[model samples]
Target: MAMHTLIKEKGISGINVHDWTVLSHKTSILNSQEIDNATNELGIPIPEMIFGNNFLSIEHKSGFKLEFKALPALAMVDQSSKSSDLIKVSYAREWFEKRSMANQEHITDVVKPYDWTYSTKYNGTNLSTDKSLVFSPTTSESIDIEQLKKPDPILFYDENILFEDELADNGTAVLTTKVRVMPSCFFILLRFFLRVDDVLFRIYDTRIYHRFGTNTVIRECSTRESSYRETRSRIPRSKGGDLSLLLDSNWVSSQLPEKESQVEVLTLSQA
Candidate 1:
């Protein structure tokens, strides 16, 4: 691993390693200009915190590539007004009608008709060719939960939030990515968690695992969700945690039901 102290890019720090397989991660807070550019390009109002300049990508000499970027991730957000999955906040109807009747200058709290919560199902973008692909309907080669439980030393570990919003104080919508490199393998998790207070909790997860010196990469993707009340019922009545637990995405995600899950494999050329 090398530092940006030797070679930097536009006030951004990057971790760079050169080999047959290269890993690069760059993150920097965007300025007002950059935020405006992102907003214009995306054609949507930007979130409260959009890391427009952040990205995590891998490139192999053998035409295998994958990347997680803020722009593409934000593009996956459901901005449709007619979408069935729109969060049903109690004040949604009143907020919509008021925004339509009131002058743009007079509008204070609410802004647009889009999914203010900014729920997204994006995992990551795989730029590999057709030759390096496989399909799996089972979890035979999925991310080994037990393996991750081992106390192996993590060589490289980093996490970053691509975007986040407070949902106008209703709840939170955030997307984050975590990467850990161990002795034998590397693992990546892209997570999108959404919570609407007293409404529902939703989580989308993407897990990728690749062992060193192997050409195979296993990816498991899943979505889980449950209503706020249902999630609350899971708490034990005798020793129940407080409502604060519901504010935690990690806790809420575990309490939800799995709606969909799939596993796939990508076969890359030996590095």
Candidate 2:
């Protein structure tokens, strides 16, 4: 229930981007009503496997905590778009088991999440004049801990769209895209976005968090970080719809789990 402090161990500390805590020791089942509601809101079907009792819950310090219930939507996109540029990334339990056979092999070797063409505009005028706007597996450069914290060099490819929502009091919503891949602890990657309020005051998020192990297990444990950039103009309506831009966000890779923390003690239930 306690959160670890944001230490300056890496020499990149100004604004704390993320802090995480493991909130679930076991999974819980979901009723039909919960599934139905989520489906209606997301415009996608919720998977049955997500209701399994064996689940993991995590809380982000500055961001949103991604639970098991949010995985399916975040991991797979609705196949409505016929554009070939849009790609979907999927994973299975076997992917994690095989990775145990080797060390130094990374998940990115096989799958790179958040592959898309990016374009930025201000008042309908393109702003990304210096660099290539496309971001994908082939174009993505390998990132380290330092790169994850800073806002420059533009590591990951992201996109944002604004829409009108009658249910929203502000009448407008913005969705900003992001993706992450973790092969070492959990063999999973998720490409999802956050629906922020008109003025960027509130956030509704969905993310992918994978679970592994049969008898005894230690799930993937790591911290995530991100930086943001605000719009220069005061009149968002005249300039552009978005109020803030996600400079970059990613998991901390340099840190490792403690030996004691990696082991678990469990009690079995009699059938």
Candidate 3:
């Protein structure tokens, strides 16, 4: 199936949005295990894995705009040292609605209609009652083309990690990558999904900054978009691997087409 169609199908399907914020000191190390544990406890699936250019940093900041095709259950597990009384949770749905209305008005006010970016900033405390954490939007004011320049403290990539893999008769081919996200990135994406039905699509334009201070933008979006015509033809068996999660010899068998008639076995194996 075409990638575009697949995306549309997933978006049109019932997908839920769950926004999250993590709190940590600037110098603290982000424990991947802790994050995994939290998500696991909530029964939310952890991302398959993380991939990026620089994995190590002192002040690591990242965010995600996820479009889940189905509304997964959400649960919050607090691991902070502070007492629960100190933690406050605030829903920004009203704030988001107001900002969106203003943006629409602003668009109509412009003489020459061009895309304008807006951002908000919220402290972690705004997110919780304890005032321990806040999130703010990063926005740019309306400036003429000549005055336009990338904002300082610019983020070259979005915090969301994309996972892509193809299951084949024998094995699967997987690829993981990160993309740059714009300010108001999360909210804008969330609104889009809320307004649309059955089809959710996102474009992440790749931007590269060379050591010489040169910047390049790659417009081809979607890390999952790939040419599989040739690769698909080369797969050996249409029904090869076992589906069993166990490693023992007892395997589940399933039927396949005549030409590809083979017993599908489930086996415990590592990816």
Global lDDT scores for all candidate models: 0.70, 0.27, 0.20
Ranking by lDDT: 1, 2, 3
**TM-score for candidate 2:** 0.23
- State the local distance difference test value for candidate 3: 0.20
Shift in Å, residue 222, candidate 3:
4.2
Largest TM-score belongs to which candidate? Answer: 1
On lDDT, the stronger of 1 and 3 is: 1
Candidate 1 C-alpha error for residue 60, in Å:
3.1
Better model by TM-score: candidate 1 vs candidate 3: 1
Scored against the true structure, residue 210 in model 2 reaches a CA lDDT of 24
RMSD of 3: 24.3
- Which of candidates 2 and 3 is the stronger one according to TM-score? 2
Query: What lDDT is obtained when candidate 1 is compared to the true structure?
Result: 0.70
Q: How far out, in Å, is residue 69 in model 3?
A: 22
lDDT tens readout by residue for model 1, 207-229: 88877667777889999987766
| Stretches of candidate 1 exceeding 4 Å from the true structure | 1-28, 84-86, 89-113, 128-140, 237-241
